[model samples]
Target chain A: MSAGMPFYVSPEQLMKDRADFARKGIARGRAVVVLQYDGGVAFVAENPSRALHKVSEIYDRIAFAAVGKYPEFENLRVAGVRYADLRGYSYDRSDVTARGLANAYAQTLGTVFTQESKPYEVELVVAEVGDTADGDQIYRLTYDGSVGDEHGYVAMGGGAEQIDAGLQQDWRPGMHLADALALAVRQLGADPAGGEPRTLTGDQLEVAVLDRNRPRRRFRRVQGELLTRLLSSEDPTADVPVPDEDDSPRASSTNPQTQRDSERDQDRDVDGGADA
Target chain B: MTAGPESGRLPSAYLVPGSSSFTEFLSAHAPALLPSRRPLPPQATLDAPHGTTIVTVTFRGGVVMAGDRRATMGNIIANRDMEKVFATDEYSLVGIAGTAGLAIELVRLFQVELEHYEKIEGTLMSLEGKANRLASMIRGNLGMAMQGLAVVPMFAGYDLIEDRGRIFSYDVTGGCYEEHDHHSVGSGSLFARGAMKKLYRRDQAAGDAVRVAVEALYDAADDDSATGGPDVGRRIWPTVGVVDAEGARFVTDDEVAGVVEAVIADRRDNPGGAR
Candidate 1:
């Protein structure tokens, strides 16, 4: 080791350097997105292989997304899912929020990154949509174990800066999936010279959502032909999917979407109510 | 229970610290207690009963999961009405192929593990986490797989966030792969998969998906002797499960009977399948 140095940088500087290092690493991967819809958020990503997905759901209302090393990110995804599920099981499902899950993941990642040399090569996002339109929360987790509470919309992956700047133009409170997806695709598809936004079809991209109208649990993947039709649909928000008879949807009076859901449950509650 | 090769004292493995995953915890405390951690013949491959044809298709608002009632050993029909599929842990169902006895044991053990996790940790693991845990358990059985007693499982469950069901397929060695739209596992998978390719639709209703499953199982049994179809005369049919926001619900025998009856009636009219 070299002898006495000027030591201009402070402890805070060291942490900032580490945080920046971690952020840069996260910025080098393909961008992942989580867009809030009427019922929930739709997470879409540009992944080629059908396997090694960059998206997953951690809880009933919480979905997880990652961009970086497949195994590393996948490990984190599994852990987050486990943690969220465990929390939901321990407490009420409503208690499992993006903020809590993101914090847990951040702590684990940060510990590994600092305690171990090979930092977890992944950046993740956890999203939870509330019963109300204003109850949505998106939490971004960095590779070095830092958590950031993101509002409105957040983007992760290699070209996030370029992608975020692009999404900034159209991202709004009530943007539907078609426009939201178009914005995501455009940012992901943009070339170096910034030609026409690259076209991303259903086969090339993965999409999922947590609809607002749904009761307690949210999280449903919209993929393949569904993705195709949704991408082409003019108003996906208007076409709120009705709850299947098989699904035991539970929504309180607080949620707008539950207006219909509560009635349905009430009918069932009067009928063959309890789960045998 | 654990025993060391030389040093006794319940084995040092039982005293080690590790992840709370019951699968991993078992791998350390009593490796032999795991399905994949057993000794077997040089060539475990034999005329053992192999389960067939499980299918899952997502509908507009929910999803439908199903399996055929057949188990075969090579060219021999081992059992006429064996349930090759089962609901392992609520909100999730697993269909097995290869080594009937072992597969059943693994499924039962898995069910216990999930329940145990919930009881111990005070929460159920996420659908994805459950899948990974299964993968690790499968990996631990690699030794048995090398001997030919392989167990491949098809996993399907609804993700509350995505609001759509997800399916996972795995190899004997525990490689977890996610299937996009629909998937099948077992001896008659190829034929069943082909049937799904033609009939499955994103807009399919849960009832429609169940019909598609019956049709697929019929097709699988038609081509593969290892696969089984509905036995109307004996009142035996496929064991089916569905998972959505409500949770995993197995198709009652009565419901299966209704679908099987309708399917039989349909097949009686058109031997070549109705589009």
Candidate 2:
């Protein structure tokens, strides 16, 4: 065998190999959640950096959230925003649609996957809010350019399977923003029981939404004290009985004092939440 | 697949990061898309009706802008009930004074420009930055201006940094200058400016400022045939907008009707208007 001569491989095997490589790379990143609720869609990512964001506003009614290589997804985010603005400028504001944006992204990703030596290790969700719940559209795009029209909720990145199962049990239509956000936080940080579940606080999570109630531009970031209030007021476990009596001493008394202490711990985690 | 211009796919210019200005991006990526990029014939003198008479005044809490409802072409009244004042953004107002069609188009594009900047940069442009952006847009229209379809606009905004209202006036060639107290533009600007010179004051109340703007437009309509005053029979009053630290808001017809009735009653008493 000559060292310079590449081994012959079937096209199917090559494509599968590239897809597996991209999937593995993406699985290493943290999870991101996109779900539908009353009045629009919400995105929650386990990210802490205020400067480098994984969830961003793409257009008036459209929002983009991605997980994978930071630089790669950030580049895609910029390009997506450019595409949206260009379309809105060329035609009309109402003409820019999430379907069109996802198609463009699919084309780009597909071309890169086939042409480049390595595939992009990224997953994207393009969501748009409409005049009514039936009109809301959510598109999930994978590294190999495959697209899925997810309904109700979509979860991706590390531990995505577990999060997806959890989301299936809790997600419902017409849930309030506070309830949906609390559920997302619980699903993202909850452990498999008999152990301490990971706690994701306000600053440790990047939260944004496409609020249909807003006029014109609908994308807005929810963070800081407001995020804290939303989490504490609608704690998903507030109504549930203690999970285990043996752990009551440690898990009990989520009183204002303990809540404040926990909030303080969360504040400390703000500086420690970087996952790059 | 070949990356041909006719392939109906996105041009690669979108994949790169350039200036945050949407106009600049359009110019670099698809030059044919920009409004300024369109070419006009050498002898193209637009015969379209032109809007006239806009008045703006600085008040104690904010700025007030008013425009009459009239369009004229070659001494003939082309249309009535034409609005020349527009809210460019949440805190800014733009009033067009010439070439009604092009001015409206420019205003709409300017609105998009501000929105695009905010979404891209994740922050609002400063009041001065917004004015400068408009100045450049007007400059781009210099070619059309030279062809006798000039567009002169008056811009007013609440300066959040300084916590006060400010106004900027432009010439046909895009020369921008800040106006103090009050300013006017359009064919009837001479008479309107004279009314403002007599009625405008420093730190007046918002209601008083509204009256002053309405009175100024009425005086302009009295002298210039192109400027139409409030038609009490049809209940058509001047369009008035107020820009404060809170934001820019257009005075509704109901509110303007009350102000117009008061102004007309006063004009009946003193047709010379505070002379």
Candidate 3:
């Protein structure tokens, strides 16, 4: 009439097992790519949901990108915003840096991994646009709380190794905004299993930038007609379309395919990737 | 600044999914950080410098806001060339009057609130929504307002949906009212409003609207001792901001000086503003 006693697991085994679980959950979702160009940093994610964003502005010059379970990463994103806002409020706006934010995320993720019954299945990238290309900084954080000071480009989530490989071969310093965006889209669409690469349209992809030349707030989304023109433009050095002086954020046009894909992804996120 | 938690993770209040307003977030997590939450001495009204005279005028495509460059204490001028007008965002501007210190703080918080909501929602708040948000923020300052440390701000923006410039004015109790074509606040507002009443015309050009604003400010300074007039010797001029379909920007010093010169030249001839 008694329950069976649980067997003890080694600390190393417990930690490794938690990491694998989190990795599997993250890998079930599509990937997000962050890269640096002459202008600033670009974040490209294969997200079809216009309402639920994968890339967001954290502060004046800093941006946040993530790939994993939507709710978990979204929680972290909101937390990061609060941290940055509070810090800026208390001290000066310049005091809130990506380094401090990354460290905070590292601490939070690390604690949740070690202490919680279930680890948060999320990966994040925080980028700060600098005055010069050399001054730009991009930090990548994994589910297990490890942080990587990435340069040039970094990829995360599903088929990240393959995307990272593609980026390593093609990404170069001082690329124009168009070139950087095209490269990111191309890498994100590349098939990881050695099949034909998918052609992602503007409606299927989410893109934003941390423009260095912009005034106080450097973070701006590149979408709608501007994104389409940039992708299809033949010349790499062509003048990118300048967004209208009207600062209103435009609603993205949705396609049937993207809508269907987003529905499926939403189901997967809610189910916690149990089927995968 | 609040000390970091021992675990180094953000406090639970931050992770709780809630309103996109930064001030709301502060009120929930760190109420002490809010300007209105601070406690003041009982029965004591702090004698703070008060900024004077802000005028706003709406033209065909956009709106113009101007403020005189003076802050006054009880009897003496506290500061000359004090900046009272600020671009709250790319498409909107705000000018503050009363209790210069608290007014500036309120402006800073309002700026953050708008930007924070935009970033979180991935969209700009409508002009009406922005004005309503400002009203709520002012309402939070009612405690401070009761003690004579009030802040009255005039907000003007280019409404994207309406495709025209709009103006909003507020009272100490946070009662927000939409003005038709023009509005003014501060100690010299009466004189400024009289000038605008005579000068404002329907569908005036942006350039004409700017001149009207400067003229109104000039009239205010001429009558009110607290309001500072154009200091030609020091080259200090009124701060002026214009918002249109393109965006909001501060008119250059040189450009404002040219308008001031024209106004002075005209005054020499008539000894009074145009009818």
- lDDT for each residue of candidate 3 in A1-276, tens digit (9 for 90 to 100): 236767889999999999999999999999999999888898999988889999999987799999999999999998888888889767667788999899889988988899999999999999998999888999999988899999999999999999999999999999888888889899989898999999999999999989886645677778887788788866443223344353431111011111112224534552212110
For model 3, the superposed segments whose C-alpha errors exceed 4 Å read A1-5, A233-276
Rate residue A56 of model 3 by lDDT: 95
lDDT of 2 at B112: 68
Each model's C-alpha lDDT?
A: 0.69, 0.80, 0.85
> What lDDT score goes with residue B111 in model 2?
73
lDDT string for model 1 (A159-236, tens) is: 787777877777887776667776777778886456676787788887777777665445566666556766775635
Clashing pairs in 3: none
What is candidate 3's CAPRI-style docking category based on DockQ? incorrect
As a whole number from 0 to 100, the lDDT of residue A28 in candidate 3 is 96
Give the chain B TM-score for each candidate.
0.89, 0.94, 0.97
Question: Worst lDDT window (10 residues) for model 1 chain B?
Answer: B7-16
Candidate topping TM-score: 3
Question: Relative to the true interface, what fraction of contacts does candidate 2 keep?
Answer: 0.19
What lDDT score goes with residue B52 in model 1? 69
